[model samples]
Target: MFSNEEMRDMVCVYSTENFNGRRAHRIYLEMYPNRRQPDFKIFKNLYDRLGETGSFHHKRDSAGRPKTLNSEQEEEILVRVAENPELSTRRISMETGVSKSTVWKTLNKEGLHPYHFTPVQNLLQTDFPARQDFAHFCRLQQNADPMFLNKVLFTDEATFTRRGVFNFRNKHAWDLENPHLVSERHFQHEFKIKVWCGLIDNYLLGPFELPPNLNGKLYLEFLQTQLPNYLDDLPL
Candidate 1:
């Protein structure tokens, strides 16, 4: 029937055996405004025992990111990743209900090189093997089967563009931006390209050019004239 606000005692209690005179309206806040909830209940202990609740809140540090991954969680992630080869690490994490970071740390610690693919490595110590080269129907065919590779003439074409020369990397190298590397640098400026046409057996064909500026007649004539010289008279 009475609200929390209206519950304040309208008149203060002054124990009197015989009630007399006008009752005083309590003005002191020491007397709770809402008798419904007094200081004793709102906050616990002595500051409140003295009838004062003090400040409602205090300042604290902001939330922070966790410092490190737990070992067991990482192991679980590694096991799941190994079992499901079709699934990526992120996908494996979702399936196993473990964190992706744990999976990465586990993989790294296990010496797994996610980028490299070599069956010999077993991804180093990682549960997943680096690669498993499956033999399909095409791979089983004579042309692809290693035992019969010598007999089949695997032919291919090569064209020369005489403008770009390929370069092999040096035995030792450093980052281009490093001061030590920059001071000991060497730059190449060569323009000599030569392509070779060949059978996989190392029998190479010519690196001939098309006419300097092609014309239909010249192209056809070159084919007719050069075809004989290049192909040589076979048992035709």
Candidate 2:
């Protein structure tokens, strides 16, 4: 009864098998009545003794629908597809001894969906080999001024989610939103965010927010906040 194949067979054959096999076993034990699977074993005795006695009643779930096969079959189909992408579900069911309908339901339920993933393309970041040359340039600067330039420190700030200035460039309307009306007065959005930083001969600086209205006034105030912290943390 504990074995999966037997349990599946039990559930397949008996409408109430699931409750009796797993859950009712516990309840029956606690009732101070019968021991072991005697409650289940009574099915045969009662069939012989009563022989379709219209007296028997079952507490079935409402709507009286036939049981859909357990999720096990659906799960099997999912494993089959992942294990061998070449085998279509029908072919898999044929070979593995399960029904095509079961396989179909499995695919839909498990979302064995086929889709595509586009690789991101960044031209500037594409030149991974140029990393060596960049390091070489930094080394040359270090040799040029050993004491002072070697003291140069570098730091960076990274924000996980950032708002983009304009989102309309790449945005698409799922359904035509006024295919004719193009007005900036009724549109707004912020898309992706990014990391920013700066560096000099013997100093480094920020990826901090510049502010919504980044002008001389706002820039000066931001500088004021960063300058003192930078000075304190600056390596002598």
Candidate 3:
């Protein structure tokens, strides 16, 4: 570690001598006759440092692996996460002084993982009673006949549009255990295709493509015509 004054003197001398290391060394020796002489390479090194960092002093060593966080830092991170399980690693790193990678490693070492949010339809309070009644009806039917559920056709529909679906990759809650996080999705107006599928008695039904603007008339027509074709093979 060369003194700032010595490094400054060497840089000045090196520049004044047309960047000739030998001449700069001789001039530096003359300037500091009583001071101990640095190695010949020191002049060139200091010159390069000044040019690169605009400083005579050495830059902090960054070549090796980054230093590990102390116990206190790790504790602070864990405590912050405990306080807010929803806190992301990036947010934790910003709040704390730890690097993002270090924060992630710390969380992982503590058995914490990021659980993505599941997207669900936005439901109204009124929908709860109907859902419960349906569930109760299904249970009663199953009690009456164990094969009732297998005989019933379970159907689902998905809408695809020019505007794609929501991406849930980045929506996550970080915790030691699965938080069972869910996000409600509201339907938006767009030109879309509605696809329908059904299942009954372990048999997969048609992945039928329904009309974009399916009204009661069109749906009834589908059931009267297209649906019968699919049901012909199955027992009534």
Candidate 4:
């Protein structure tokens, strides 16, 4: 590898005559006939990109499968991932002092795969007891009666909107060119509607539209008035 100082000297030599890359490269060849020089294409691209400092830039290794991680580094990266499954490839790269691509390759070679972070509603410590109680109740009911599910009513409320959110990491569009192209959405003016529904046995009921800023009174009214109408009209 040429030192940075040697690269500066080379740049000076190439730029002395204000010559184009091809002529400079020819001149360079004549000057150092015994030294192996980069291809004309590479030299041209470097000059076009870096100008007078082209030779100061290190040459990239385009040869097949250049090794970035040694056995020890590979093991260290694996251990880092094993300790923290949530560590992103970028984070792993920073921690292990390697490029993100190297970290990713190391993980894949060891049968590990990258995955996007999944979003979920956060539950507090207090919520766990309620969840456990609901699970226990369901288990007991299921144990007591084989047809327990048939007698139960399941209800939920949801919102519909003109806008939607998605994880770009989990989505892909394949095309001839760069397949990882991104799409931007504009939602300056938005509209949404809230709805409630219930299901029992073969009955799928009321996607009833709800008013804005629903409270206990509105919910109780819905349970008392709209829910009964749906239940009364249940299929025999």
Candidate 5:
């Protein structure tokens, strides 16, 4: 439901940028910083529709009943979602005087989907410096040797237990793509088994199991003993 002027501006930017939706969106934001910016999919859809029909509007279905939602109503739905992405389709329908199906249809048409939030460990303030230092060290190593990353083994461990933790499936963040949203949960003392994995030089290493309570001693022992077993076949 963009105005003629706005649509024209979008078209100008999109064409100039070689039809890159993301670049067109950035230019649109620069042109109208104060306006509510539409998602990248909106720009692409508008451009495709214009190309197919020579019009900025959607063609009505001749065989079926009239559209449940008009262009203005669809835009209203999008605006409401942008304002509050957590809003459910039922709630949006109630506020916008449309059916839940229509609201869902509008959002689906715009390529919006519900993405669940990922569970992450809560970080302490003191951890920030270490994280930054590690990132800087990695960047320096990459600059020093082009193959440094390829030779380095990236390893991570995750704990699993019977105890029920946060249920991320119950909550969702609706968007055109994964927002990489995370909900921090403080560590809780529970019976758990840790699984470790590593990757280097296109080789996948160990789904090795470790005791629930890990310490520097146990970790060093694993590196000095068990780690060698896996590295025997590696070029390292």
Candidate 6:
């Protein structure tokens, strides 16, 4: 003795699960073992309607509870959000002629959630060809020798600083000579010392200090001198 809307809801679920209407009615009956099943003709009609519309939701009833945002308005909200992801919820509400809460619910249902911004390094125009060539070479090496990666010596240069971490409040000193709180800041410009290092298999190599005015020839000489010592120690 289910109401018309309740019967329609069951029919919708059935049609979605079992695409065939006749089979859906049998399963729907099995869903409620004790209760009397609805008429097959009515169930078939609802199933047909569901197939045509491809929607499980019941149609908006004029006499029933009023809808703040109709299907068309909800779709409009999705479109606006897609066009500009940075639009705020309030802005989306205004654009779609719906309330903020409605806009939020719509977006939530669509698996869209708010996220905070994060900073990352962007690729330069010159990097594209280099990246592609590196990838191609790696693929060729992978095909030629599976253990090629283990044989490679990865090297890079990084800087270490003598400056200790200090907040804005500590940077200022209460010296009466210069009440403006200015001090000789050597760490601001010349605190960093650059060093080069290499890694192979399980061994860590030298953190060799680079020359004060390092150039391409100096770098090549540095590598030529340092790499042989590390490579000789490698296991056969």
Task: Write down the TM-score of every candidate.
Answer: 0.30, 0.22, 0.55, 0.61, 0.53, 0.45
- Per residue, candidate 6 scores C-alpha lDDT tens digits across 1-236 of 24456556667756676656566667776776654454444455555545777643345333422237665456556655654678899887665557788788888987889876776779999999999999999989989999888777788897767654456744666665876754444655666677888887677777779986788999898878976876787673
- How does candidate 6 fare on TM-score? 0.45
> Of the pair 1 and 4, which is ahead by TM-score?
4
- Error (Å) of candidate 1 at residue 6 is 60
Q: What stretches of model 1 exceed 4 Å from their correct place?
A: 1-67, 75-105, 116-153, 158-172, 175-196, 200-202, 210-228, 231-236
The most accurate candidate by TM-score is 4
| Tens-digit per-residue lDDT, 156-222, candidate 1 | 3334343423433434466667455323233464333333233434444455655555567985796
C-alpha positional error of residue 83 in candidate 3 after TM-score superposition, expressed in Å: 2.6
lDDT (10s digit) by residue, model 4, range 18-102: 7465676677778877654533333334344455544334333334433466544554566456546778987776665777888
Question: Residue 96 deviation, candidate 3, in Å?
Answer: 0.6
- Candidates in order: C-alpha RMSD to true structure: 26.0, 17.9, 23.8, 19.3, 11.1, 14.1
Between candidates 2 and 3, which one is better according to TM-score? 3
lDDT per residue, candidate 5, 1-236, as tens digits? 46777777778888888999899989889988977677765676677778888987654343433347765567667866875788988788667777788787888988899776777989999999999999999999999998889988899988887554665656788999999997755557646789999999889988899867899999999999999898897766
Candidate 3 residue 184 Cα shift, in angstroms, is 28
Which of 2 and 6 is ahead in lDDT?
6
By the lDDT metric, which is better: model 1 or model 5? 5
Tell me the lDDT of candidate 5: 0.79
Residue 23 in candidate 4, Cα distance off native in Å: 65
Q: What C-alpha lDDT, on a 0 to 100 scale, does residue 120 get in candidate 2?
A: 79
lDDT of 3 by residue, 7-90 (tens): 688778889999888888788889888865654556776677678778764333334323387544565566567547789887
RMSD of 1: 26.0
- Give lDDT: candidate 2, residue 57: 24
Q: What would the TM-score be for candidate 4 when compared with the true structure?
A: 0.61
